[model samples]
Target: MTEDRKKGNSSKWRPQTMMVRGGLTRSEHGETSEALFLNSGFVYDSPEEQSARMAGDKPGYIYSRYANPTVRMFEERLAQIEGAEDCRATASGMAAIHTMLVAPIKPGDRIIAQRQLFSSCLWILKNLMPKMGVEVTWLDGSDLGQWEDATRKPCRFALIETPSNPLLDAVDIRAVADLVHNAGGELIVDNVFASPILQRPIELGADWVVYSTTKHMDGQGRTLGGAILGKTSKIVDELQQYYRHTGPSMSPFNAWVVLKGLETMDLRVRRMSDNARVIADRLATNPKIKAVRYPGRSDHPHHNTHASQMPEGGGSMLAFSLKGGGDAAFAMLNRLGLIDISNNLGDAKSLITHPATTTHRTLTEHERAAIGLDDTWVRLSVGLEDPEDVAEDVEQALAGR
Candidate 1:
């Protein structure tokens, strides 16, 4: 470790402090901000140095596809905040998910996953994994009994997304982790919805944690990035080979952008959660709304589990079903003059999406119904806007119903 790393590790700085200063390595110039090394290749002092680096005898970046200084800085900073031994940054959220799922397992391995997940993730499990000769079993994430029953037969891995996409369903991470462990399987938690500011899955018994840094980390909706955090052995030893060869590496520029965004992640996530809570509460009272789901709210189906696992807040996302179904949902979205219609979440600007038609469109009607995602459901990603103003905009949109 360098002197800067030693200092950062020795000091017991809090999350906010670490976000600003953790894993920061200065160039010889001593610049105030993290330097972006945009070069695709690095120069070596001699052929001996290049041979040593290639042979793993020396420590230096050989190629951008394998590693880069700016990307390393972002990875280290994220690992510090996440309390992980190491981390790897990816090109996008889906890339991170694909890497985590495909790296450790082989043909005939069994993987269990929560049925309620982002459509892309669902496709990987239900469609892609099988082609690779991997068997997948989908179960209700909120049900501890189902998780236990499913894990009775040992599986290679298990995956789940807490505060599930569009629906905001919370899963019991600790219990599920314990079950998966006893079954001799690793647990991977997709924590994009919860954000690192509110949830740390590694501390809750998850063997690995994944995030779409594109979301809350880059709260400005600027860059697309993803991260995987776990033991150094798992990341550097096991996953690095696949990552290096497959080339899903994050760009140096995107890494730098996300590094800057991490500085304000803690503040922005909390503010957005606060705004989401206000909007969810207001929407619950509207007669045109049939149902509302926000983990921060006490009435949520798994509110107790959410409280125990995610004590920080409900997160910046929420979902509700309109009484009039798809047409009314589109009408309400069209009527909104403030909130933009978008499929992306965790932005500085509030975004709303109709999941049945957009994010989860690939699923058949029966599959959609099985997950309780109907035409009326609308997913909202609350932003850093004033809570009252966001509430008013949502309320006025409902008036059009």
Candidate 2:
């Protein structure tokens, strides 16, 4: 451990140092593990102290809905890793995204975003906000022309998801951020696909970064949580305000789970990403696969862009199309004995899912087609299993094909 860690000076600690030691508060019992404060409320010495707590004169937590010790530890530790000034943990990924995206723009404000995003995020920008009178101009992220055309005027927020779900479409954050900045908009990035270990969007010029902590942060598929992180007053003025009053707080138990999860996130993400790079390479050469979309692969269209953004490796998720289309895809998915068929990604167990049915099913056929998503596509989240074991299972699934 570094001297910064020894001193508990979070600002001076490195990412790995921050992950292991940041935000740790020990009880009088001197337990090494973070104490889980499971109560709904806190007690004070006197009415004056209670009033002070409620008045924000005191720095302690009043209600679990607004904050909790365990959850704050989780937030502080993540903020340290992510290089953010503040972080707010929420009930789930959707809550983090919704709070970050919805809080800034009122009915008359506008949003410019890519068409390629997690289905639920798309719903917020495409379906939910439109009814409330917010205008969202969807664009193709890969094409700088669309971004240029859309950001010619001012908008409240410009959003992108790098190494986008299922497809792994990596967009240029700095490039888009420059354009958005010129137009006076804050850039919001969904950093879940490329966890903080792989990419820090705030450093890439994103004003706000969001995550489904249930994914890589939890690492074990054991809990539901989300976080929104930012380095500016905007986090306090806009996002935190929405977070506090709306009561989408993360549970202390879940926070404790993720706190433990964070201790090893650096290890798990790197291992899973390594496993994925190997598996993506193995699957790419298979004649049964029509195409492969892993950032580690040289042929991936976004390889260069993704490489710049995610310095560690191509992340653990990959998507490939079956040569025989949907039927062959289903056969391969069903035949895989080791990998489970599930929509969730970023778990310790390798998971495969048909996005056209499970994740992106909400997208209209036209929408899916526009993003080049077809029935043949299957998304894979490589896990921490032995590479050979995982590869053998995948190859066996493709044997007859």
Point to the candidate with the largest lDDT. Answer: 1
251-320 per-residue lDDT for model 2 (tens digits):
9999999988999999999999999998999988888889989987879998999988887799999999
- Measured by TM-score, how close is model 2 to the native structure? 0.97
Which candidate should be chosen as best, given TM-score against the real structure? 1
Clashes of each: 0, 0
For candidate 1, the lDDT comes to: 0.91
Those runs of model 1 whose alpha carbons end farther than 4 Å from true positions after fitting are 1-7
TM-score of each: 0.98, 0.97
List pairs with backbone clashes in candidate 2: none
Write the residue-wise lDDT of candidate 1 on 249-271 in tens digits: 99999999999999999999988
Deviation in Å, model 2, residue 130 alpha carbon: 1.2
